[model samples]
Target chain A: MRVLLVDDEEELVATLAERLEMRGITACWVTNHRAALEAVDRERFDIALLDVRLPEMNGLDLKRLIEAKQPTMKFIFLTGHGSEEDFNACSAESGREYYLIKPVQIDVLTAKLHEICAEQGDRQ
Target chain B: MNGSHGKVDTLGLDYFGRMTASISHEIKNGLAIINENAGLLGDLVALTDKGRPLDPARLETIAENIRRRVQHADDIVRRLNQFAHSVSGPVTTVTLREIVESTVALAHRIAAMKGIAFTFSQDDTIKVETIPFILQNMVWICLKNIFQRHDSDTNLTLDFAFQEIETDVVIVMNFSHEIDTAATKAAISEEGKPIILFLKAQIYNDQTNRTIQLRMPKKFID
Candidate 1:
């Protein structure tokens, strides 16, 4: 599956992209609002992994703009500042499958990515 | 800006919570990076089990990343510790530059949320005897007021410069919120008057230049 990873922490997202590539996922990463928007504008991504907090704009706001451009793209949020309780509350609205906290287990992330894509019947 | 013991107490708790939350968010980011670094190492190890040779340079890079991230987290904790200890005494001796830097560091995430940048510098450092926590809170309140007042079309950086005025320190803050000096000064006065009275800091507004200068004595006598 092709994925777009957006987070201000460059090394974290870059390494994640590398790992995803190793797992046969075509993933690209960006560090801020502008670049992430630009990437989605220029390239097609099946799913997006976004950090909830960004320096300049809310990641959810960025997600809306991206969704406008790529209406069918899937999403998973990764947050550092939020607690599991916060995630649970957000999950009630967004879904339990939609959020992951920092220090993610690779197995869990990979499985979630597959699950989300499989639900779309577009497993890659 | 209400001068009441209960109000100040509430404000202190609120400021403390904000600072703690900001510091923890920063530490969590550092931890997140370190997590990715460690996970990359695990990925490398898994490759080795499959008969793929490990690239020594890549291992070193991961190791270095972890090291650097650890130091980053440590520095964040250190600053938080210092900030926490700032309230250990009602009054203490501290360098004006150091306290201002600490205040700015703590306010960074708050500013980033507003897309506001800060530029601070001082050619000379002056030591002062004052209430560190209260002084920091006052400066932070003023900065927050500036952030709230900033309604310009573009993202703006607040410029702050410190000058020694004999026995006092003057922090000159410059920004481009508006050219209406009277209105800006009135807004600041409405919001920050109580803290200004408490700290005995005089504030000057220069509308033409778009600046607010806060001047306070170096020594606190209580």
Candidate 2:
């Protein structure tokens, strides 16, 4: 499965991608909102992991852009920002069921990704 | 600003609440890191179970990473605990030096990220009958404003000098880089007024109960 991860924290994103790769999942990573948009256009990803806070465009805005481009693509929010406000905002949308806080449990994410991918395939 | 009218008690509680929010965010972030690292390690265990030969070095690194995250979480909890105690008392004789030091320590990382150097000085001789929580919150808001407006290459310096004759402690908030002077001033006034107002309310509540006594100083040393 192809996965795209975006976060401004290079170390966190890099570490996360490496963990995903270790689990036999091929992942592409981007650091900014613009790069994420460009990546979504150029690549076919099964899932996208996005950070909520970005320099210009936030994750919610980027999610809208990616969803428009790839209607079938799955989205998960991976953020270090933990507030009741953030949680509520993230849960407001459907298809965005998975809101994982950083630093994530690789096992939990691995299972979630598999579940989402299988669910997507069944729906299709 | 309302603190100028001798209402510091209510402002103290508001300040405590804001600090609790920020510090809790910090602690929550730390916990998330630790959780993620442990999950990764658990994933590695699963790989081993599948007869996949995992790198011994990676295993060792993961162990070290978890230890580091635990230490980070501990530090955050410690800071939060100290901050909590600062608000437990309604009125106390607070040392200006300790308040200045703690405020600097609390805000230094945030300021540094904004490319602003957070600096402060202490006067051992300066002691004030003040609500420490309110004072710290006011100082933090000022620091946050300075850091928010600081240019990438400039440093924000906060100097404190106590006037012995006047019996007042003076804090100087200076910026090396210029920002929207009007906006920055407005932000300071806007964010700071509620906190000061709340502190005033608490002081009034305490006065009515006669639980503690508070005195208003006669001069402003800005």
Q: In model 2, which runs have C-alpha deviations exceeding 4 angstroms?
A: A7-12, A30-44, A53-57, A64-73, A79-84, A94-96, A101-107, A118-124, B1-10, B49-56, B90-97, B107-117, B120-129, B144-166, B194-222
Error of 2 at B87 (Å): 0.1
DockQ of model 1, rounded to 2 decimals: 0.60
Cα deviation of A11 in candidate 1 (Å)? 0.7
Worst 10 residues of 2 chain B by lDDT: B204-213
lDDT tens string, model 1, A1-124?
8999999888989998988888889999999889999999899988999888877676677778898999889888888767765586557635877888887877799999998888888543
Candidate of highest lDDT? 1
Cα lDDT of model 2 by residue, B24-86, tens digit: 656665666566567677777888888988888988987897788778778878887888777
Clashes of 1: 0
